[model samples]
Structures are given as C-alpha cells and as structure tokens.
Target: MSKDRPAPGDRIKPKKSALVQFTATTLQLEAFVVAFAAVALYGLRDSLYEKGPLELSDPNVIWVVGGVLVVALLVLSRLTAKPVGLAGGTVAQVLVIATGLALPMMYLVAAVFVAMWVAALRLGTRVDRERREYDAAHPETAPNV
Candidate 1:
C-alpha cells in the first residue's frame, strides 16, 4: 500500500459531495444579495409605499426587488467570470423593471425576479463546477493543452 494512503480503520471522511459544495458556494453568493436586499428594503420601505417622492407607490417595491436581482446577477457573473447566464438574467431583469412600472403587477414581477435569480444561481454553480473539473483534468497542460 502507498505510504500516503489512509489505513483501513481511518475515521475521517468528507461529508459533502461536489454537488453539495457547489450548492453551498452558490448559496453563499446569493446570501450577500439577500443581505443587500434586506438592507435596501428596510431603508427605502417608506418611499416605496406610494407616498414617497417617486409617486410610483407599490411599483417602487418592484424597483427595490429588481435592483437586488440585478446586483445579484452581476455578482454571480463576476464571480464565475463567465457570460453564461448574463443574457437570461438581463431579460428577466428587464421584465422585472417593466412589470414594476405597471403598478398592479408586483406579485408577478416578484415571482419572475425570484425565478430568474434562482436560475442564474444554478447556472453559476454549474459553471463553477465545470471550470473546476476542467482545471483538474488539465492540471499539467500548458497553453497548448
């Protein structure tokens, strides 16, 4: 047996699979977005209630939510350093912004925004995993590899 190999009775083992690790990293990236949304919502709630300066009423809530969605999308794109989900995210974001302006469709806007963000997060996780696997498989390759 190789000297570096674990003994037959070794007790330690890693609990997480690659999927779990990818999920955890994706969630970690989203957590920052969630935190930022919470802070922005708390700070601007009064202004989004139709009585604020924008006069957009409930529409302002959409703005706040959309803002968070966009920021989160940007962060994910940057973290992955890939354009994989950017186009889809941008489309969803545009839908959010437009739907918000309609004033009475806040729920739909929120739902779509949430769906898009989740999709983007998943895409990021996949990208991260694929990249990691590629690096592992090509560990010793130079530019020609």
Candidate 2:
C-alpha cells in the first residue's frame, strides 16, 4: 500500500460535513419560496404576460411545473447531505432560472436565489475549514464521536 494509505487495522472516524448541512438548509428554504412563487404565478397568470411565454396558454401548467420543482427541491435538500448532492443543487439553480422563460419577472427572483446558493456554497466551505482548524487546535473541545 502507498504511504498515505492506512493499514487494514486502522479505522477512521466519520464526521458530518458543515457544508452539507448548510446547503441542505438553503435548499429547504428555497423550496418554500418556490412553492409560494407558484401560487403567486397562478394568481397573476391572466394579469401579467398574457400566459404566452413559450406558448404556455394554460395556467395549470404553472401548477404542474411548480409542484414538480417544489418536490425536486425538497428531495435535493435531503440528498445534499451526501457527497453527490452538490451537483443536484447546481442543476437546481439552472432549473430555477429557466422558470424565467415562463414568467419574465421570475428571472429577478431566480437571480436572488442563485445568489443565495452561491453564498451558501462559499460560506459553508469557509465555515467547514475553520471548524476543522478549530477542532484540530483544540482537540479537547471536539466532540467524542
């Protein structure tokens, strides 16, 4: 085995990643926002844009797509605790912005959420690094997990 590899008898403890927790929380909140946006979209469909964006003349489409997004977001939030979950979060950002195609004003809303997502990723990573350093510096304070 290579020098960095641990022997078969060695066991490494696993700790929860702060980044994953932060990201998952962000996603859960975003799902809530999207759900409300869908309701507002249904109400304003006739008053704004004439429901012609992408030939979507039926308001029911709004409910269907919105419901799908809400469910997808919640599921993504649960998955975000896993290693591959970040990729789903990235794809979710794209999907959120794409909703702008159906409603022009949503572009602005999507931009705000996108900004939040970026912040979570960056800030969470920083917090995780700092947490690791703190634990390393003061092992006595570390949890006995």
Candidate 3:
C-alpha cells in the first residue's frame, strides 16, 4: 500500500513546551560539565593528598559522586516535562553549585550554570505563556494533537 505525504502546511506541528525544552538543555549541558569534572578529578587524584585541603581518601570518590550527580542531572532533564520536575531541577542546581566546596574552581563553573538555569526558568516560562496566548487566539493550530 502506498501512503501520501501531507503538504508542508498540512503537516501536524508538535506542541513544544519551552520550559521543558530549556530545562532539559540546561541539565544536559551541566551533566557534560560534571562528567568532565570527574575526569579532571581523576587526573588530580595523585596530587589531592599533597594539596591536603580535601579529605578524599579514595581516588574513586570523584567518580562515584560525579557519576551520581550526572545521572541525577540526566534524569532531571527528563523530569522537567512535569511541574514537580521544576522544583527537583532547582534542588539539583543547588547541589551542582555545592560542588564548589570540594573543588574551589567549580565556583566559576557553578556560577555560570546557575545563571543559565535561572534564565531558562524565567525566559522559558515567558515564552510558554506567550505561546499559549497565541494558540488560544488562533485555535486552528492549537489542538492537543
């Protein structure tokens, strides 16, 4: 059986949620950075004791902690499609910033990501709101489908 393709304008447009999209993007990027931080910590493993400020007794500590945080971030990325995920994402952001305590340099990284998260929440919400209003005004393209 042959199927016909819809005209370009007749094709269904998916309803994209700005908040979820932005939150996922932010979490995914943060996950990548956290993964890199794990690798950097592995490189610094030998020097940690000499530096002596951190009490990490095992070299694998970074891998374990960073891995968990990365997983949490990735999960949060999916969860953002829901309302509860917004709060969860905020909590995750705090945890990411807290990494600054163990790695002082993470303060810079944390600040940048924190700013991005805040911007995502603010801007994404605004965009979503505007999109809803537009859809409401023009109902032809606003069906749940």
Candidate 4:
C-alpha cells in the first residue's frame, strides 16, 4: 500500500486532555516517590534516632530506592513532557497520596508525607517547565495560550 503524509499546514494534533494526562503521570511519580520514602524512612529511622544524626554509611536504602525512583521519574517526565501528561500526572499524584496515607508504618508516615510534598513540588516545577517549552515550540496547540 502507498503511504500518505499531511501537507505543510496539516499538523497532527493530540486528542487527550493534556492537563489530565499530565496530572496522572505526576500522580504516578508522586506515588512512586512516596512508596520509596516509606521504605527508606523505615529502614533509616533507627539510625537517625539512635545516632546523633544521619551519616553516609547509614542504611543507604533510601539511596538505592531513590536511585530507582529517579529513573522512573525521569522517564515519566520525558514521556509526559506535554500538557496532557501534566493533567494525568496530577490525578496520579492524588492516587499516590491516598495510598501512601492508607499504608502502615511506625514513624515512617511522617517522612513519607514530607517526601510526598517534595515530590509534588519538584514534579510540578518540572511539568511547568516542560509545558512552557512545549508551548513555545507548538504555539498553536499550547493550552491556555
């Protein structure tokens, strides 16, 4: 079969809700971070409390978990670099938050909460930056432009 292509003005468009998509993706990122923090905190709390303060030689579980999370976050950030991803990410963030709260922990709950906040803020900033860049590149398709 022969292939067809769009003319110069026939720019392909996205159909999904950029905001919703972004929000969902962001939620996923947040969830992953929260879960990671839970594990990390649970693993490190003893050291933090027993010793004077945190040290490099501590459990290091957080580093391991955080490293994995960083990869996932980076991938999501790249994939959902568009407005749609931001919307989806937000939704995902909510789900993550809810799940995080439901889980059990001795004192890890507090650390998880803090991590969630940091993840949300950081992810929001990244999404915002991506949206700006996307808007600049595709002025016509940019949301609320």
Candidate 5:
C-alpha cells in the first residue's frame, strides 16, 4: 500500500480545526439567539398586548413584525459569511431593544441577548487567535481543509 493510502477498514475523514469549529458554533449560537427571541415574543404576544401600556388595539402586530424581522435576519446571517452574520445579529439585538417601546420586559431580554452576542464574538476571537498561534507553532498538525 502507498504511504498516502489508508489500510483496510480505515476511513479518511475531513478534520475541522478548533478555530473553524468555534467560528461555526458561534455563528450558529448567534442565529439561535435571535430565533429564540422571535419565537418567545410570538408566544408572549397575547400577554404583551394585555399587560403592556401600548395603546394600539393590536399589539400583536408589533410582536409579529419583530418576530418576522428577527427570523429573516437569522436566516440571512446563516446563509452569509462572518461580517453579515455579525451585522445581522446586531440588528436583531436592536430589534429586540426596540420592542421595549411596546413591552418593557423586552429591554431585559434584549440586554441578555446582547451580552450573549458580545461574549460569543469576544470568546470566538480569542479562540481563533489561540488556534492561529498553535498553527504557527506546529504547521504539521494543521488540517488541509
């Protein structure tokens, strides 16, 4: 058998480095955050209408619109690259914040999501840096992919 060939019963598999894995995970988490917010707001639409101070007869409109926007942005973020994903996440957070105008509780929810977004970006960057340093120090271990 050739040196490059795997022996019988062996399988060749593509390997994702830590940096790639972390980046993918972070993006997915960001998307999930917005998606969760959309679903939650939609679920609480009736409650918000009943308890919120908004004078509109159909407060569910706000919830539905916001949910749609967040869900759309989440889909776009997942389909695009890092910059688009980050921007979409930011916009989704802003939408969440804007919901505070209708229901005050959204302010707290927005803040929590914002915190999570920041943590994901910062920690993912740190992980990327470490992965780069490791790759630089040990080039042989780096994956071809």
Candidate 6:
C-alpha cells in the first residue's frame, strides 16, 4: 500500500461532488439568478437601442452600457464569497430596474428578474438547510456527493 493510504481498518470518507460544492451556498444561487438576468438584459440590447425612447447621440451606447452591466454581474456572481458581492447584486438589480428610464419594456423584464432573484434566495436557503440536515444525519457520507 502507498504510504499516503490509510490503514486497512480506517474508514474511507467520500468527497462532496463538484455540483454540490458549486451550489453549496445561497449566495451562489442568488449570483446565478443575477447573472441570468444580466444575460437576458444583454440579449435585448439591439431592440432597446433601436426602439428605446432615450435620445442619445448613438444607440450603440445602450448596447455598450448594457454589456458592461452584464459583465459586471457575471463577475459579481463569482465573488459571492464576500459580503460585498451580495451588495453588488442588490445594486445591479437597481440598475436593471433603472433601465426602464431608457426602455419602458425593461421595466417588465426587470420585474421578472427581481422576482427570480427573490425566489433564488428563498429556495437556495431551503436547499442549504436541507443539505445541512442531511450532512448531520449522515456524518460519514460526503454531503451531496
């Protein structure tokens, strides 16, 4: 046997799966919802730019700004380990709602995303609770492995 290996009588413990690790926290799920919302906003760029009521020198400005917001939210998602990330998400949601100033249609989109974000936070919390309970019940089993 390899020197690093445990003795014959030692118990082998399973490791958590990658998916479980990735979604282990409520922040992660909230970040995911925010990121999804960002992408959805980006997808509407062309339409918003062309038909949006905002009178800008160039319609492309909308696309550029929206794209930046999307990228920022995506980055925030990965930074949810810190409290600031959640704050950033809240700010992002406000910005999304503010998009209505440029494109009235965005009000509806933003509302939908906000609903989704709230749902993610609530559901993620429940899932996390369940995971903790499961781990408590099965001390020897790797959580969500």
* Candidate with best lDDT: 3
Model 4 ranges off by over 4 Å:
1-14, 49-145
TM-score of 2: 0.80
Give the Cα error of residue 81 in candidate 4, in Å: 17
How far residue 145's Cα lies from its native spot in candidate 3, in Å, is: 3.6
Report the lDDT tens digits of candidate 6 across residue range 50-123. Answer: 54565434536645775677677677666644657657766777887776666566688778767766665566
Better of 4 and 5 by lDDT: 5
- Provide the TM-score for each candidate, comma-separated: 0.32, 0.80, 0.84, 0.31, 0.63, 0.61
Query: What local lDDT score does residue 67 receive in model 5, on the 0 to 100 scale?
Result: 59
lDDT, candidate 4, 29-108, per-residue tens? 55455657556555655553342233324446545544554554445555565655545444444444333332334235
Give the alpha carbon lDDT tens digit for every residue of 1-145 in model 1. 6766555555434332343344334434544544454454445555544422233335456467656665765454444433444444445445444434433334464564566556655775686677667656854331222
**What digit string (tens of lDDT, one per residue) describes model 2 on residues 1-145?**
7766555555546467878888888888888878887877777766745542554546789789989999999999999867668889989989988877766677898898888889888988898898789878966455456
Give candidates' CA RMSD values in order.
Answer: 11.1, 8.0, 4.6, 11.0, 5.4, 6.9
Backbone clashes counted, model 1: 1
Which pairs, if any, clash in model 3? Answer: none
Among all windows of 10 consecutive residues in model 5, the one with the lowest summed lDDT is 14-23
- lDDT preference between candidates 2 and 5, better one: 2
- In angstroms, how far off is 145's CA in candidate 5? 3.8
lDDT of 5 by residue, 1-145 (tens): 7876556555535443433344445445644655565565556656544444643335467456755765665575454345765676666667767766655666786787677667666776687678778767955554444
lDDT of 4 at 18: 47
Prediction 1 TM-score vs. true: 0.32
Deviation in angstroms for 74 in model 2? 0.5
Off by over 4 Å in 6: 1-53, 143-145
- Model 3 weakest lDDT span, ten residues long: 1-10
